[model samples]
Target: MTTMARDPKGYYAVLGLDPEADAEAIRAAYRQRVKVVHPDRDPSTRAREEFRRLMEAYAVLKDVIRRAEYDGVAPAEAGGESDFTPMPVACGTCGSLTAQPRYVVFRTVRSYLIWAKLGRLDGIFCRDCADHAAARASIVSWLWGWWSLPGLILTPFALLANLFGGSKPRRENTRILLRQARAFLGRGDLVLARSLAEQAATFARGPDDRARVAALLRATDGAVSGHHRRLKSRWRPGGRVFLAQALPLLALPVTIAIFVLIAIRPWDQPVSTVAPIAVHPATVGEIRHVAVDGLKLRMAPLPGAPVLTLLDRFTTVEVNAATASPDWVGVRTPAGIEGYVETRALYAGSGSRFKTEWCSDNRGAPPTAGEILSRRVSGDHRLLVHNDGRRDGVVKLKTLAGSTVLSVYVPATFHIGVGGIPDGTYRIEYATGTRYSRGCALFIDEMQASVLPMTVTFHYQSPTATRSLTNIAEVWLSPQSGTVPRPLPLPPDRFAADD
Candidate 1:
């Protein structure tokens, strides 16, 4: 093979023309070059080789399908008049002579994080060869194509293209049927030939093709055919064709189901045989706070037992150990309602007190009042927040859109100046409670909170060259007078700190 046959763009160079040269120019150039390099005229070895290369270039340039392939472009239509020929060509796979060979390109992509590579298989193939090529490319791509970001995007298109028909010039159904009809006619199978020729005549377009089909029909006339065309049956398991098509599609779902079954192993779970805690003797009335928020007071000690009522934080209850279970204590609410609450849900002291000594460690060494917990931007304004409530407080300055810009901790009855606040409208959310839990980073056992009903605004102004003004606002969690709006109740979950 000449270098022109190996190089895609060298075909144009072999014809002594640029890539932009049209079909007419290519044909004219080939005609002019052929005369000088004609082997019969020169009768030399070099002349024969040059003439062969020249013919190769002319063959590709003259046909739309070949030209598009050489140019790395997808033709809008395939198998035009110049593309189809009645002469036989050797199939790339089987190497047998076939009248209706299709030029097809199957593609697959393997991608990495930063790069990707395209794998291509292109050849002129007969029907069985093309089917084998398409199936092989699609199966390989389905198995290993999606390895990177680009592969995720490119692999699917490649797989679909291969599975459907591949991206290349193809003989249409009419031409294929006619080719089969001719083969049957050569074998003297007149009945099948007549049926196929009749079908081809219906699909034939243009005067020449229609006339050719008419001639085939006339030759096969009067042949009685009993055979009828039928659609291929749907794929079934254990069949070679079915496995080739459906295996890739079903691989992911089957793998996921296997993993789920292995991970859960619901069938082989071991049963727990540990006995429950022994119940203690009776105790009279004892006051305790419902330490946990939303503690369910159930009718019985069991978790699946019906709930009598939902007890909120700081709710007082009289404990009755007389009716207590190993894990539960009987309690009577102030409303004279009785239910069994989990023992862990009740605290001995008032809910306003800390649960343990460790929980109270942060009380004296409270977080710096003006500490900026989170800051998006710095500005020339400041906020002085006062924690007038008996409980310590942490105030959060959040944008009206609910994004927190700053947070400051202020101990009970103390005030702090928080600086470096950006100039924007903000909602002042404040939480006040007894002792802080480091785990929760908030007052857990007893907590009450609310947000300012109206938003506060801070703006910076430089009125003159020598004079500069910065906005400063003073906010009090507990309003000394009716002028300030009373804080609206904030839900515990909303005021809860991030983990």
Candidate 2:
């Protein structure tokens, strides 16, 4: 026989008997204690003491009346037997004896690895409180679970645990709440019905319960609609809703007036005074250079005509006549070889002529081509061409000897470097293909190296066909001079052109 320890307090404690142990429990405990501490088998002083204590505990606990008397005297001892008690406990919230305390265990990753059991003791609630608690917890889980990324993963588990893991009360409470909602609906108390339906939905434990509550909520919604319609029908024009609806209508006229004021305001605009571009009258001149290298002198004005000879820059040529087409000029080379060359490829003394009637800036005679040419003999020059208004044109630069230096297409504004034309005088020209009703202004800035800058302004209008005009700008710089010149300001002119 195995010997056991003696209890210090009393006979009940000696046998490990709770003060409230019944006769059957007392008898069973006595048998188990005696076998462990039988004096005959364990011949020791401690065994004798254990055996005696066990017998004494059995004597007092076997009788119901005796156990009750002992419990009354030592009430603290009753706590030890609380877990084994078959009787129900009063609910913490409902004050009902139907609540039974139960332990709910959860197996988590940490618990599994440590071979540990983690649990919480909750009320073994009666159907009502259990359902209410479960429903409340499930509602919380649903409302807050999706707030975080991790929550989305954990929420279903939390919701399921709250709804069905511990008690069945949540399911029952949902049914009760739904029935109440329906009763309110039948009585035509729509607000109360909707409120109850919503609450029932929150507590619903399963999909089927939730679906039924959803149907109830829908029915209550219909009743709510009818109630709202009645309220609307009775509302007066002076009421808040009526005023809110009328506000937008009242604001429309004011908005229209503001836009009208903006549209009709008078704007002070300048008048345009650009003259139409006329072709320069034909005059004898030499080909100082070709604007494009390897220019071919063709027998006829058309591109596919037979090539008479290939011409390079500074080739001497004599102008015979101006063609109906402004692009081709009839000329004869010093070799007596007659051919047609592009008008843009040569510099001639036939300076541009402007219609005097359209001259906006008649302040002084427009600078002559010769005057502009004299200034370019010695240095580098920067040419800035600004086209005002909607008109567009191409501007070209060539040596007075007829060597084409640069050509730039201008839609609005353009700048070109005349520095490459070896410190000599060159002609500046502008032409447009399209006819314009108003006309456009051209502003030229001649920045000559080591010389005062000169600005010339011309107003051009092409009332009919494409026209070409040429003038002089001086560039004075040695071929080795790498200096960059800046464009001068445009002279004042009386044409308003879009930038």
Q: Clashes per prediction?
A: 0, 25
Candidate 1 matches the true fold with a TM-score of 0.38
Name the weakest run of 10 consecutive residues (lDDT summed) in model 1.
230-239
Residue 388, model 1: Cα distance from true site in angstroms: 37
Error of 2 at 467 (Å): 18
Alpha-carbon TM-score of each model against the true structure: 0.38, 0.19
Q: Which residue segments of model 1 deviate by more than 4 Å?
A: 1-58, 61-90, 97-107, 112-124, 148-150, 157-211, 225-242, 254-439, 442-499
Candidate 2 per-residue lDDT, tens place, 1-499, comes to: 0111112247666767654454566688788888888977898999998888777667756643334233333233443644221212233345454212222221111122224222222433444554555555545554554555556555555544543444334665465456556555666767766776666665787999989888877877765665443211111123443343245335646877878776753221111212363334445453333333467899888879899987653345678766788778788876798888876655433212122122223223333211222222333334545544243444445444444455444443323333323344445444433322122223332211111233232333346734433343433222224645433323222111111
Model 2 TM-score is 0.19
